[model samples]
Target chain A: MGGSLNINHLLFLGHGALWTIGLSVIALVGGGLAGFLVALGRVSPSRTLRLLAATYVQLIQGTPLLVIMFLSFFGLAAIGFNISPLAAAGASMTIFVAAYLGEIWRGCIEAVPRPQWEAAEGLALSRSQRMVKVILPQAIRIATPPTVGFMVQIVKNTSLASVVGFVELTRSGQIINNSMFEPFLIYSIIAVVYFSLCYPLSRLSRRLERTALQKKPALA
Target chain B: MGLELDFSVVLDRWRSLLDGATLTLQLAFIAVVCGGIIGVFGAIGRRGGNPLVERLCGAYVEGIRNTPLLVQIFLVYFGLSSLGLKFSAFTVAAVALTINVGAYTTEIMRAGFDSIVKGQIEAAEGLGLSKAQIYWHVIIWPGIERVYPALTSQFVLLMLASSVTSQISAEELTAVANYIQSETYRSFETYIVVALIYVALSFVMRFGFWLLSLALFPRRRRLGTPL
Candidate 1:
């Protein structure tokens, strides 16, 4: 009840900041893989696969990530999965990120000109080959800006993991505040730390978007 | 351990869930309206001739956009009390959500404003329209219409994000689920039901926005296309 902010507190926060980065990496990689599949499913020729993917996106997009975290952490524990807070937070972030990234990538894939698809088909390429050889190379460029932008979302959303007791940046702030009894000062620091982590990515995403727009005329 | 899914226990607490859902909607409604207003002014300020106003607006947008809402909520929830200003959890939650969503709304609204071509403004001026008239008809209305879909999606996302307010104990639907699950010891069932309720709420919000768009943008309605 009578503690002041000190070096120890800053060190604790630095440690938590590292975990935040680690968890974000886990979510980005895992969610990127799952989201790629979801994107493919959305663009698939099979009607059933398209519907399945659409439903998944709808459900996850509709539900809040906080609820998903609670569901994975406590719901799974109740059903005997009994995973750690890190696992639960990681899985929830992956599921939530997948829905949004899948939608983003789907738009990217579809943004490839219709004529290009016809040309690939005219060249006697299979669907997979068309995707790999002709479509994806172009889609990747279009996907870069938004994907980077969504990374900012992923970084900020990791704060919600503290609810399940994951010792990330936010949780570390809470822990320190528990001792310091200084909410405003502590949370202000936490917000600054988060801003430092996110602002660069936001600038990068904007730069990428500008470059992408500038290149569009050349491509067309 | 064997898993036995039970819905009946959670269903018994439907009244609480309904009240929570109502509060959730109420919070979202207030934030959307207030945030929309802030967004309008913010967009104007950012694009205005005043450099100080533009820089302040820019900072506000960037600061809020780059930070997590949960921390912002905490800052608001405790920041007020520390200043010896007393407010309810609901008020704090609403204020925080409004502030958070306002930044996003500003960005979206600014994009809308930017999409207004210089030719349109020049044409309006050439037609002898007053500055106020030009700002209203040529600038604000069309700008909003251009960004209506993005604004709609942002409001829906704001609704989903209201769940984070439960951490400050605002007694929203998610908070209600936390309570019910603790009481019934049916965490899985309670969250599943709450999740479905949230999904329903999002659908309802989206539908409401669509209807509003129809009423607001008669041109869109007539042409059957979004501006």
Candidate 2:
């Protein structure tokens, strides 16, 4: 308990940082897959589907990710699901990220120029073909910068997984602090690690946004 | 395993939930007002002529934006005590939230500020308006009007984020749910109820903001057009 910060503690933090990345990847992939469907649903021709997707986004957006974590972890356990912390954290993150990414992607999808959609229609393309060959390509270009920006959010939000006892970067710091009694120092290190991870993505997102903006005038 | 849903048990503690929701709203209110003030100044400092102030403001925004709020809350919660400052959990929660939201708000406010065309400010000056009058008539009000929607949404998000203060045991809505569930052994029912309450609160906040917007922007209200 009396020992100061050392290699083992730093090593533990490194391990936790790895998990933070792992959990973020899980969220991005799972959320991306689900968010794609949600984006599709939002833009779908079916009124019911669009309404349903919108409702899901609103509901999830309104509730805090922390509450979702609790509901998935302890709440599910009480109801007899007995989920592991990793599974619960991953599931929660996926649900939370899907709602946000879905909205972002929806905006991207909608941002596709009206003439592009009309052109696809004029080309006698089927609805699926139009989406696959035309609309999505444009949308992907519009989506890239925001998608990268949202990745920073996904990484930051992954810290909430620590509340569910997921042993991510923040939780590991808590554990070290429990023994070393150095909350500020440990948490400062943790914050720095998170900053290192997120700042690059933030910069990349901004750069992509600038390039996207430059390309816009040419396309127009 | 059999799944049975019973909300009645959770509903029995509605009074406590109400109290918690009230506290959540209070925390959100304080943070919004305080963070918003910080945001305005931070935005100004970023765009202002002083290179040092601009860089410092930029660093603050970037540092806050990149790190997780949980870590920031911990930093405030524990970092303060380590320095021998005594404060309540609620105070700590509010301060952390204010700091967190201020960064995002600064970015949004800066966008709002940037939307003001230079010609308008010059025109105000050509009309011989004082600096304070120019700022109010040409800058601040118009800037806020342009970004009202974004600003309100950010505030609503702040309200939702106030739930994180529960981690510090601030006795907000989420923390209250934690306590009730632990006592009642109705964790599922409790969180479900709490989540719905949050949804309701968000709607309430949105409606309130809409009403405020209507009153604040008479031109938009009269013309029925977005600024």
Best by lDDT: 1
Per-residue lDDT tens digits of candidate 1, residues A35-81? 99999999999999999999999999999999999999999888788
For model 2, the stretches where C-alpha displacement exceeds 4 angstroms are A217-220
User: What is the C-alpha interface RMSD of model 2?
Assistant: 0.8
Residue A200, model 1, lDDT:
100
lDDT of predicted model 1:
0.96
Q: lDDT tens digits, residues B4-91, model 1?
A: 9999999999999999999999999999999999999999999988999999999999999999999999999999999999999999
Give candidate 1 regions above 4 Å deviation.
Answer: A217-219
User: How many pairs in model 2 have backbone atoms within 3 A of each other, for residues 3 or more apart or on separate chains, i.e. clashes?
Assistant: 0
* Interface RMSD for candidate 1 relative to the native interface: 0.6
Q: CA RMSD for every model?
A: 1.0, 1.0
Q: What 10-residue stretch in candidate 1 chain B is worst by lDDT?
A: B218-227
**What are the per-model DockQ values?**
0.92, 0.89
Per-prediction TM-score, please? Answer: 0.99, 0.99
Lowest summed lDDT window (length 10), candidate 2 chain A: A211-220
In candidate 1, chain A reaches a TM of 0.98
